[model samples]
Target: MSPSPDTSTDTSADDVMEALVRSAFQVMGVMTRISAEHDLSLTQLRVLGILRDRRPRVTELATFLGLDKSTMSGLIDRAERRGLLKRGKNPHDKRVVDVYLTPAGHELEQRLTDEFRRDLAPVVDRLPHHQRVEFTRLFEPLLSPPLVIKPRVTPQR
Candidate 1:
């Protein structure tokens, strides 16, 4: 059965849902263009963006990125070959290599983020001042907790 429509406006719920999807795609388009400007794929940009703040091992990164180990390894390998990042062993173990962004990685990440922000600024600025403030307030909570850039550490078994 179809769900009841929103009472707040004449627009149907489907319209609002469709608008959300379209808005997401619009953001994605901007993201894709920004990623291309830095010569990286969307997934690669995603990985670097996640690594911008802190380092994580391959296993942990895979879980956070929702990628398998082999796929994550390939991304890391390509990035490493491009001099964007490097792998080094965990301080307490000779075999556990952690991934970290290099100076170039940091530079690219920063540029990609800055450009994306610039691209988005106009969109947000087009809204009325109250809507802009409310949007920022609403968006803040979407980035907390489980969305952490660094995964929580667990004791080795």
Candidate 2:
């Protein structure tokens, strides 16, 4: 006979948050394992992801990534050497440098995306319907909202 669900377990907000944090670590572990197949570091993959979305200045990337200028520069240098990214002068401002994804970077991103999906597919497939629904509800927030900067316009004083 199948085991009964443990309804006695706590499902409070704090408990949910703790579970989410633990789940995030599990997801990171999976991502690391899959990403290692490409011989790329997580930071490199993240940088490419950002570049794929928009051309950002080196300093902007550094700020967004929460890395010091030197560290980000080194990462960009390595990725550039791998032919995954290119740094060019911003069209609007020659003094501003912008980073963008090369064709190879795009290909790698696609491959990594596929690998991540493959890694999670089995576990996701095995989940019960209600559990799957709950998982989706919990994870959607992490994937959807990138940042929460305040509104551009301010009220008149």
Q: Indicate which candidate wins on TM-score.
A: 1
lDDT of 2 by residue, 1-157 (tens): 9998665574685687788798779888987886687787887867866777799999888877777789989999999899999999999999999988899988888787787788888867899999989988977887774653333567799
Residue-level lDDT tens digits of model 1 in 75-124: 99999999999999888787888999999999988888889889998887
The residue-level lDDT of candidate 1 at 156 comes to: 96
Number of backbone collisions per candidate: 0, 0
Q: What is the lDDT of residue 94 in candidate 2?
A: 100
lDDT of candidate 2 vs native?
0.82
Model 2 Cα displacement at 123 (Å)?
A: 3.5
Name the lDDT value of residue 18 in candidate 1. Answer: 77
